[model samples]
Target chain A: MNRFKKGHISVAVVCAVLGFMISLQFRISMEQKASLPYQRLEELSSRLLDVERERDKLQEKLSALEEAAEKGEANSLSDQKASEILRQRAGLVAMEGPGVIVLIDDSRLKSKAGDNQNLYIIHDDDLLRVVNELRAAGAEVISINGQRIIATSEIRCAGPTLSVNNVRSAPPYEIHAIGDAATLENALKMRGGVMETLAVWGIQLEIQASENVEVPAYKGTTQYQYAKPAGGGAS
Target chain B: MISAVCGLIIGLVLGAFCPLIIPVAYSKLFSVALLACLDSVFGGYRSVLEDKFDNTIFISGFFTNALLAAFLVYVGDHLSIDLYYVALLTFGFRIFQNLAIIRRYFLKKH
Candidate 1:
């Protein structure tokens, strides 16, 4: 009886019991607090995501419906503009699959080592041209550097590098565009295309035609608590 | 202009600072191994990954990041090596922040 009241073992037992009781109380409280807010947060986020997803899906559906209507309709600049505008409005993140890769290295700008100008470095303008022509040819998805190029995307030049949608990228720009291989190539090869423009500038342009193109996900955050659909809701 | 000179100075200063701050190579090997594991685990389809991520997600991320630190040091240029320390410190800071958050959320006492 005296020993039970005495050493480290007894102290440890008492401590453990106290700890367990405290933990039990804490756990119950956490569960209680977590329910209301956690459930609400989850529900709201799920709702927001569902709304965004439906918007994306419906945009594509609308465009397809419009195109079907235009199939036998009048031929005018207005029609062309409308279709192009529709494509831009229906922005979707491109995913990748089987695709051709064109490796263009400059023959005149010789260098086998670091900072060689001879290496086929795709510029913003070059990538922009390719993407534009591909979209015109009815390519579904396009990507570079794992960043999917949505319809509203912008490609620009920023001091010694290229920026697509304001993200910096460099060299042998792997252009993954998904669509009908033959149709896309035919469009790219047409006058004032990706290849033609580069060829005239003495910069080597390589053409690769593939049946499948695997695009990567865009690397960035998607958040804007504001700067949004402002104060309206059509979705 | 002054801005050009300032930029040049900053670049040179960073370059000078790199070698001093970079840790030895063994740490890098550890980091690379961790990254390889993460890569292998997340390399494919979604069905396997989603459920595992719901709880205890931070454990995997912490291990992955700790490993990356050593790696970035190994491959980093002079400027990057200096920045590596800042990354390390930032990492530690994040742990403290997370602990506080978890304590507040779970323990209900600050």
Candidate 2:
């Protein structure tokens, strides 16, 4: 009886600790499921989308006004050519040329237990780095998973997926660029370059050079809210 | 038994509100350790019912089993092995077995 009573004290202590751990794990998993920062990000992202839509409508109106000016004040042939070149440079027109198509996917290695599963997944920075390398290699126009890269476009993380110009896309990210195909492919495959770095994590990358790769036009708005023409009458 | 139940309830409430910041990496280890503790408690309870309880063994088993389970998980993480499942299965099976024995003992006594 005495031994049993003594054992109860030890049992009570162990039970207390067990209960504590159970509750603690429960709270932590719950907190992760509905974190405050994640909630805030979702709210802000929706608001950004709404504002982008508003900006798109304004852009259309501004383009209509520009068209009217072109018709009323007959512009010279050289001026029209220059404006067309500018539109192409601004990624407003779809571009097609000989370039490379890079297909990058998550690491093929089986994620170990208790290891950070995020390490095996593709990240926004990986896509950003690949885009930057392509640009440096003289890519004329680039599109990631059909979303064109623009001057004002943002490539960022939105939870498990990547948000490019406020549009979410998942992996196996396919990047298409229109430029000198050889140079683009060489840039990615350079020693210690983006491809090699990604290979460290077993991220699969396949670069295929094609004679005709289509880069779509930037569909997002480019309305400048604050900045105007520097000379005030350049147009 | 009553003190054990009351202590468990109080501990659960206290832990829930304690605001302890556990790292995301160690959450898995914590779960394995918790399972080990649970297994130890059930085993100890069974021994007490059998009238063969040993206080020293109970105390030591509780700590060692929890630590060993957590260690296995940690090693598994480093070695890229799923040894966590091994610890999980072992403790999970032990918990049920102990419960079954305790249930049989109660029935026999009655």
Candidate 3:
């Protein structure tokens, strides 16, 4: 009986530990499912697609170079034109066209007692959502407070300020997009869109359509170390 | 058996209400460790049924198995190799073996 008692007690203790580990793991996986880090994975996969497209472009450029060599013509003028167009597409060159200017600022409404204060602040997510909406509406070029939004650009929060392409800026964020002005404005003002959600929090948002909206050139370095063009150019 | 079931129930409740929040990044490691713990519990239970249970062995095996599984996951992540699958398959096989033996013993008794 005493021997049975010893074995039984040890088994119980082990079972308790097993139960604890199971529940803890369940909680962690549940939390992961509910969180926003999945967006980071989506961003990285999109970046991979962008690199693949760049690889395709380089392949086309290689074919063009070979044809120029066969013709024995100095294609420097056309090469210059090709590079200029590439730079403009890469957001390295400043752009100007008819589009809409959006201004979003933190809410001025005072938070009631026991309310979470973060709801009233303009977050990086808010800016990202607006930029995504504009892109979906076929915006050709976009910038935030003169900082161009390129493929590799990032909008991240850093304490009281937000960093777009590593340049820190605060609200009221001035977002300029050069596309069809009416389309961009309509995208922002769509019912149940990002603007409506922000309005619920009393965030200040204003949109103005104009004949000319100038978006500045990207100032950051466009160098990449790990990702290489597949198949054709170099290794 | 009753004590074991009660202990498991108590432990589950305690864990559910606990405020510890492990980051999602390390959830894979924790999951492997949990599997190891589960295997240990089943092994201990089987030993008890077979009259071969040892307190020192059961307790040490419980800690060592869980720690080693977690360590394997950590090393696998750093080396970019999926080594936890090894621990997973081994522990998984042992758990089923123990469960089969326990089921046979209960069937014979009835």
- For model 3, residues A1-235, the per-residue Cα lDDT tens digits are 9987886787677778777777877777787676667888899999999999999999999998898889877577778998999999999999899999999999999988999999999999999999999999999999998899999889999898999999999889999999999988999899999899999999999999999899999999898989867787663
* Cα lDDT, model 1, residue A192: 74
DockQ of each two-chain model: 0.01, 0.48, 0.45
Pairs in clash, predicted candidate 1: A95-A215, A96-A214, A96-A215, A97-A213, A97-A214, A98-A212, A98-A213, A99-A212, B31-B67
Which residue pairs collide, candidate 2? none
Ranking by lDDT: 2, 3, 1
lDDT, residue B26, candidate 2: 91
Question: What value of lDDT does candidate 3 attain over all alpha carbons?
Answer: 0.89
- Ordered by TM-score, highest first, the candidates read 2, 3, 1
- Candidate 1 per-residue C-alpha lDDT over A118-138 given as tens digits, one digit per residue, 9 for 90 to 100: 234556667777778878878
Q: After superposition, how far is residue A141 of candidate 1 from its true place, in Å?
A: 0.5
Q: What's the residue-level lDDT of A178 in candidate 1?
A: 75
Between candidates 1 and 2, the DockQ winner: 2
Candidate 2 lDDT (Cα, 0 to 1)? 0.90
Report the lDDT tens digits of candidate 2 across residue range B50-75.
98878898889999999988998999
Assess every candidate by TM-score. 0.36, 0.50, 0.45
Q: Candidate 3, residues B1-110: lDDT per residue as tens digits? A: 79889879877877888898777687778888888988988898899899887888988999998999999889988998998888889989999999999999999999
RMSD of 2: 16.4
Each candidate: fraction of true contacts kept?
Answer: 0.00, 0.70, 0.68
